[model samples]
Target: MRTKLSSTIFLAILACLLWASAFVGIKIGLPYTTPLQFAGIRFFISGLIILPFCSQRRDYFRLILKNWKVVFVITLLQTFVHYSLFYTGISMVPGALGAIVVGSGPVFVAIVAHFSMPDDKMSLKKAGVILLGLTGVVLVSLERGSLSGEGKLILVGIALLILTNINSGFTNIIVAKDKDKVPPLVLSSASMIVGGLMLFLFSIPIEGLHFSAKPFEYYAALAWLSFLSAAAFSIWFTLLKRPGVKVSDLNMWKFIIPVFGAIFAWILLPDEHPDVLSIAGMIITGSSLFLLNYLNRKKIVR
Candidate 1:
């Protein structure tokens, strides 16, 4: 049990790293490829890679048919709308700023889950922590000068990203409720397949069915995003099923992602350097998330 726990933690950390790197990768890749094209191809590749690994092909299909409504709703909310908003938002705003904005997702998730999931109730302590985290995020946003000029546009983008997070939280609640009835792997696989196809269809008019870039880095970024989507999500869903791994537990490690994302964005876009205020904000954000997770875990243990 200890070994399994350790392995799960390791995989979760790996997922965090991959997810963090995705922000940077997307920023780097965007210069070479259109957002729609990037999103479409990434999902398509992810679906293809995960298709072979799916166990019980007949059962997978059967589950899809059995729960078509649930599957479609989740795919639309989690994949279609979420990725579209996120990718479009990133395209409009600076990657690090975008990361910081979206990093407040846990707070949003907590708020939404509190009302939606009885098992995931929010406490006053968690609320305080979430508020502190949001303050830190706001500080980072202000320090990045995302509150001025075309910053208004970025704010709109951030709002859209927050909506995506809310939808994701709701999707989690739905998944948690139905996890026993439907295999997570099957659900995840079908969502990707359906979601990928939807994005591909949307990309037709926006990005067209064309491939232009041949740069190694561009291809590498695409591969990374695709692999993470295809493989990492399955691992994530499995970890979610494990006892004691609450959604709140996942929020603790979320802060580390923005730090790496900010660094990577800074490296790739030298113009977007982090000021001292932004650095302090990152520290505060991390601290608050840590406290939130600690408190939640303590409550769980009791």
Candidate 2:
């Protein structure tokens, strides 16, 4: 049991790290493409990347057909609605800011899971830990300064990102509840393919067929984004299927995303840099995860 728990934790961290880097990748790629267009292409290719690796390659389409509802709903919410809001939000704000907004997702997931899953109901202790994590995220974001100058654009972005989290909370619940219905890889591949195609097609009419020459850097970012989405989602979906995994608790590990996301943006983006508050926030966030794990081990909280 201990070994299995350790493995789950390790994989959770690995998925979080991969997702963290996506902020940098998205920022890198968005310079050359529309948000929906970039998101669509990235996810479509990510689905293809996962296809060949599925165990029953011959029965892939059959599995998708059998689990059409699960695939369709996940495709609609996770890839399409989630990424559309995500890409649009991130494009409006700085990478670190975007990370901070998205990092608050666990809070939403916790709330959503509490109401949706009897077994995953919230406890005061869990709520406190989540808030602690959010505090750290806020501290990291404080260095970005007031939205007074950035105006309603950043506000709109923040709102959209929050909506994405709410959507994600429900999506995670569906995946967890239906864990036995379909394999994670197959679900992810099918949903991403359909969702990505939807976004790409929709982008044509909305963003207006924008195909132009982009630099090598753009392709590199796009490729890296696709690969990360493939690997991270697969890892995450697999974790969700594991027995004893709580959607809320599992998502607490995601607080690491903003900490690393901010750090990466500081290092990679010429315009972004770490401040004292950001570093302090990272430490607090890491401490929150430690507390969360300790509590879980003690079985003090769900």
What are the per-residue Cα lDDT tens digits for candidate 2 across 96-195?
Answer: 5776778799999999999999999998999999999999988887776553337788888989999999999999999999968889999989988899
**Best lDDT among the predictions, by candidate number:** 2
lDDT of 1 by residue, 1-302 (tens): 44654576577767777777787677667788677767877877777787777786768788888889888887887678888987777666765467566877877777777787667777787778777777777666665554333657777787788777787777766766665655667777788778878987897898777766478988888888898787767776777666656665555455556665666667776677888877887788778856854675565467
Judged by whole-model lDDT over C-alpha atoms, candidate 2 comes out at: 0.89
| TM-scores for every candidate against the unseen true structure | 0.84, 0.94
| Model 1 CA lDDT for position 205 | 90
Pairs clashing in candidate 2?
none
Q: Give the alpha-carbon lDDT of every model.
A: 0.72, 0.89
Clashing pairs in 1: none
**Residue 141 deviation, candidate 2, in Å?**
1.8
Runs in model 2 deviating more than 4 A are 91-98, 149-156, 300-302
Model 1: residues with Cα > 4 Å off, grouped in runs = 1-10, 92-97, 138-145, 151-155, 266-275
